[model samples]
Target: MAEVGDDVYREDPTARRLEERVAEITGKEAALFVPSGTMGNQIALLCHTQRGDEVVVGEGAHCAYYESGAGAAWSGVQFEVAGRGGLFTAAELEAVIKAPAYYMPRTRVVALENTHNRAGGVVFPEDEVHAIAQVARAHGLAMHLDGARLWNASVATGRAVAALAAPFDTVSVCFSKGLGAPVGSALCGSAETIAAALRFRKMLGGGMRQIGVLAAAALYALDHHVERLFEDHAAAKVIAAALRDVAGAWVPAPETNLVMVDTPGIPAARFVEAAERRGVRVSAFGPHRTRICTHLDLPREEVLRVAEVLVEALREANAEASAGMGAGTSAGTVG
Candidate 1:
């Protein structure tokens, strides 16, 4: 059982241990545990920005695409996408910075996502991150990292987590995602930034009593789950290799645990249904794209089985789409 106390009063021993461990791992002066990744990101925004500020982000960032406009609602900020395909270079970031004027939305922060989600889990290049940080500092801007899958990035690239996080002023990391913890994410930054964020966390209703019960799970994940993420990455590669030869299926080499399949001329829903029927569940990422992820629950043997099932499902869906196209063409010709 975890020792528990009031986190709002800053006395939760388990929560304190998790925060300290995350801070040390990320090379930050302090860390604050929050309820979800969204809240962590939102709190970072609040700490960095005043009302009516602008934040630069890469396309398809989780904070922009998946957070349901929490940045706008909670932080009073708007986003400007710096580059295409969810990863931006320093020059691309510089191009979007607003010129100094009373009439412009003052540029305040640059946020990045590692293992960019909607871009099919590509890892952000380390050198590029350092260059971007240089640009941000020159322009007096702050940096925040949506590092929800940073653990995956670390294992994929063989870089330490602190090295990857060094360029940012604030970093939000999730325990629930690849780490296999059931609940919690943490925002790590300088002691001053985290102190400011604590007030914001309370204002936003994030304060909790006895949060150490949940914090212990996150601690356990850090001890046991971080290194094993490589297994999930290997599983993703297996799936991608299996489907690469299937007709009408375009599978990219996954850099992490996320595998995205593009099924041109066949609806994503069609492929998803086909996979489900064969006992493999996948998400419809777009009209013609399906997303599959390997996680803690899916063992090596199960992943191998999934690879075979996905190949058959892709072929079945493709054939059905071609048959429907032929039927429509014949009907038009007869008429």
Candidate 2:
């Protein structure tokens, strides 16, 4: 029923229903579906700012490092990255915001990530989110939440998704991630903002036909998959604990479904390569950290396997590093 008609004409019943459901979940006036989270975020920036406008973001935010400069390339805007770990204090936000002088690009938007990915899936405190929102409201700047993992945050914090979304002018959530949908994301905002976003999505060639198939999967995930995230969170913490004190690499107990291990002497990329050879998939975040993320598809045995793989990889990296140091010292003495 959803894909039977066209969405560009607002005639796809399933897509329309999915949009309405997302809006209600996020407590927004309206919603628009897009192909990917990147598109959803880029559309938000495009709708919120004009050419030369500045957007403030976190130093390790997806919009900053992962989006390939889409904010500047497509929105014709520049970005100012705030503090590390994807959280900035109200004062920090205020400090980065520029006065509307002719010489400076006007700061039109502030984007935040909840369950910040690069920060090892740290959840932003609710009060802290409100404080940042107050600053943005005070300065007449718009707020956007890169809430791709907000479902995980909601489950981890035991907070309603609407409460998490309350402070933002726009919030984008992903279905393709832990939600287990094949492909889709939605941008929720006021009716006016979504209307502007609709045009921007089309402008970016994001409008799709028969999106209802994907929306159906997302809807199912919302109903069935959300409550189960606690399982992933628990498993991730277990994995982190298991890999603790392995080769000088320390895994912080997971806050959500992501576990980050701190490698002291070895780089995360090298560890990732070594772990991959052992049949584990992990991503290198910053120079010193490697991250393991748990989702619906990752099984208990797989999580255990990944933990073992990480331990062995760290041992290999440590041995290699010690050997390199020994060789360097021997060469120096020989010289």
Query: Which structure among the candidates has the greatest lDDT?
Result: 1
User: What is candidate 2's lDDT per residue for 1-335, written digit by digit as tens?
Assistant: 33545778877788888899999999999999899999999999988999999999987888867888888799999889777667888888989999879999999999999878878788998998899999999999999999999998999899999999999999999987878888899999999999999998888998777777777888888889888888899889878888886867887778998888887777676777778798877777667677788888888767777677778887887787766642111110000
- What TM-score against the true fold does each predicted structure earn? 0.96, 0.93
lDDT of 1 by residue, 1-335 (tens): 99999999999999999999999999999999999999999999999998899999999888888888999999899999999989999999999999989899999999999988888889999999999999999999999999999999999999999999999999999999899999899999999999999999999999999999999999999999999999999999999999998988889999999999997787777777788899888887777878888899898878878999999998888888988843111110000
Overall lDDT per candidate, in order of appearance: 0.91, 0.84
**Top TM-score: which candidate number?**
1
Reference-based lDDT, residue 259, model 2: 85
Root-mean-square deviation per candidate: 5.4, 5.5
- Candidate 1 shows a clash count of 0
